[model samples]
Target: MTKIEKKNLAWGYLFIAPAIIGLTLFIVAPMIFSFIISFTDWDMITSFKWIGLTNYQTIFTDDIDFWNSIKVTFIFAIVQVPCVQIFSFLLANLLNSKVKGVSIFRTLFYIPSILPFVAVAILWMFIYNPDFGLLNQFLGFFHIPPQDWLVSNKLVIPSLVIMAMWMGGGAMIISLAGLQGVPNYLYEAVEMDGGGRIHKFWYVTVPMMSPIIFFNAVMNLIGVMQAFNEAYIMTQGGPDKHTYFYLYMIYQAAFKEGHMGYASALAWILFVILVIVTLLVFRFSRNLIYYEAEVK
Candidate 1:
């Protein structure tokens, strides 16, 4: 309990005060308010009316649309997350190699990641246009008929999944950083043990990269669950609501449908799902993630 120690501790707390305040104001406070709002039937124009668990009951028991949205979101997470991760990892591996114009290639690949989701959705709409789009034009060369991508119920989810990969450069960059951190001696040792490229990758690179892969997978899972802009901007949850994502449902409830309290309930439900899913991933990943520090 030295005077100088107390003064230094106070200074440290002062330095971190802004971050604490920001977190409370922006994240913690809103979460608490949203939880309270979820319990009441409060459309923006109407006075708040306490409804208890009616919203939850309706969503679980009666709302086919809500269940469909849940199904769609689950499918999106399952398919999109793995695809994006694998693609990004491969791209990172390619970019990690020493090659001419590699920096330019890296920049080109990463450019899509920085583009706004709204702009990406709009851009893809042109590409998916059946009449005279680039995709159809390409298919014409192969003598295949042009397909209505986003307009077809069966194809819409897949189309969205494909479009989701556009921003995978962020994950690629993270994978690249992880790759760089792998010690050169490990690969050299693997090579000395009659290990070929595949062997080295599977035995050395994969285990070393597991931590990064796990990190990227968890983050992508969260983001994909909350996907909105693509479904909203591109498809508007169209083609018989096949592309309807959960966040789009929430947006419609909160803003377009004027069901703010219902939307708040949906938001809280989604938050719980996100937490559960994330925890499940972490729990299962216990045996998979490898740390160099843990080996010794």
Candidate 2:
């Protein structure tokens, strides 16, 4: 209200103006458009016609593929999220140790995460090829029969989960940084209290890293829920739609089926699902996450 206070507020707004503009133009505007589209019946070729709740009704009742996509998405998120999080956490912990060439090893591990999705998909396609692929060749040495990975309905999603974990190097790096931020004094103190490795990890490392772990879990969950590129490039949602994730199904509705309204509705559903899941995660984290100062 005072002149000095007004001047400070003006300066703060000026500093954040670019970010505000970018968010309005890119994120907020598109979300509004998408919500509007969800209520209409429009192909790109035709004018949008308002058809309230039709898209939503069809997805819940008439669209079998929509249900299938939801099921697949749920399964993928459930399996991949925890597996990748645990693996990345363990890897970060291992890499946090005082080892020789840790930087080189870290770089090598992280290269996959930086690779373009198209390149990674193609590379994995070869690796998962049924005949004469690296995986089959490796199995041959032990006299195990060659298996169809991407083409098998039972195996395709799991294979994708494995590929996702392999390239989850970015999350691992974040967890490593979190691990390093844990005070060494806490570990030493635990040891003096007659704690062993597991005790120290349970009391010190886990509590200290709780916030980062929660962050990584939420991020990975959101990413897996929107999985499309791998399903598109590798399986094409084939093997009887076993890998038909939600986003890929949305793409099909929009582009292949010429059902833009339906696609928009699906996108809205996915957005809602993500928001609910994230909120649930935050609710659950109240019991799990332990700030260092609060613990004392």
Candidate 3:
């Protein structure tokens, strides 16, 4: 190889070295350690004793809280993912239009997403307060009775879903990019074919945007399934354990209860479930996800 080419290759490696080192030290090492620890029984203070599949067995056969966490996580994901995707897509559509102050509107909508989760949780807490909260105050105008939001067993999941929608702008921005990428010529062609707005959207916009929508939906699904901060700060998985997400349970096991090994097992279970769900999403989306490169 030429001296210049070899030097360039070395420089490339040098530039990427920090990221590689960080990944190895932080991500790879911990993952391996966690997997090894999952088979043991250890509190943070005690030496680990190998327990084979006892943790797994306990989760399946004995632990009611583990099962409850699983159920709560699935419910959260099922409601949150679709709501975020659809709401974001709708907002993207609105922002994609040629309107005055559209950029400002986009910025306003995206503000909540940029705020730290802790801050968002705290802000929503005041809004959800039953007695003098903004939501109840707003409802009072119509003589509607005040309703408990995060404090109610029946309302906790829905409250989280509402909070989730407020942060939809991240996905909305991606959808806007996808919408803008759809060739204007396709819409023109639809119009020339005597198509209305509905036809143009259904035939051209929806198909062109399908790949973006699919990508966002998959990411949202993953995010919702692993949700923790909102439950941790807003509800503490309270109101009859309605918001006891699997990750929250894992957090409690590791930090609160100091059952490090059990927490590691729970983490691995979550990882496996996520992998399966991601694979299934890709498998099933084969017919649904459209690509312009595939067009003949």
Q: How well does each candidate superpose onto the true structure, as a TM-score?
A: 0.97, 0.95, 0.97
- For residues 1-296, what per-residue lDDT tens digits would candidate 3 score against the true structure? 99999999999999999999999999999999999998999997878899998888888899999999999999989988988899999889989999899999989999998999998888889998998899999999999999999889889888999889998889999999999999999999998999999998899989999999999999999988898997789888888999999999999999999988889999999999999999999998899878999964
Q: After superposition, how far is residue 33 of candidate 2 from its true place, in Å?
A: 1.3
Candidate 3 structure, TM-score to reference: 0.97
- Candidate that beats the other on TM-score, 1 or 2, i.e. the better one: 1
Which residue pairs in candidate 1 have backbone atoms (N, alpha carbon, C) closer than 3 angstroms, thus clashing? none
lDDT of 2 by residue, 69-125 (tens): 989989989999999999999999999989899999899888999999999999988
lDDT of 3 at 137: 99
TM-score of 1: 0.97
After TM-score superposition, the amount by which residue 19's alpha carbon in candidate 3 deviates from its true location, in angstroms, is: 1.1
Distance from true location, Cα of 94 in model 1, Å: 0.7
Could you tell me how far off, in angstroms, the CA of residue 232 lies in candidate 2 after the best superposition? 1.2
Q: Residues 161-271, candidate 1: write the lDDT tens digits.
A: 787787899999999999999999999998898899998889988999999999999999999999888787888888888778999999999999888889999999999
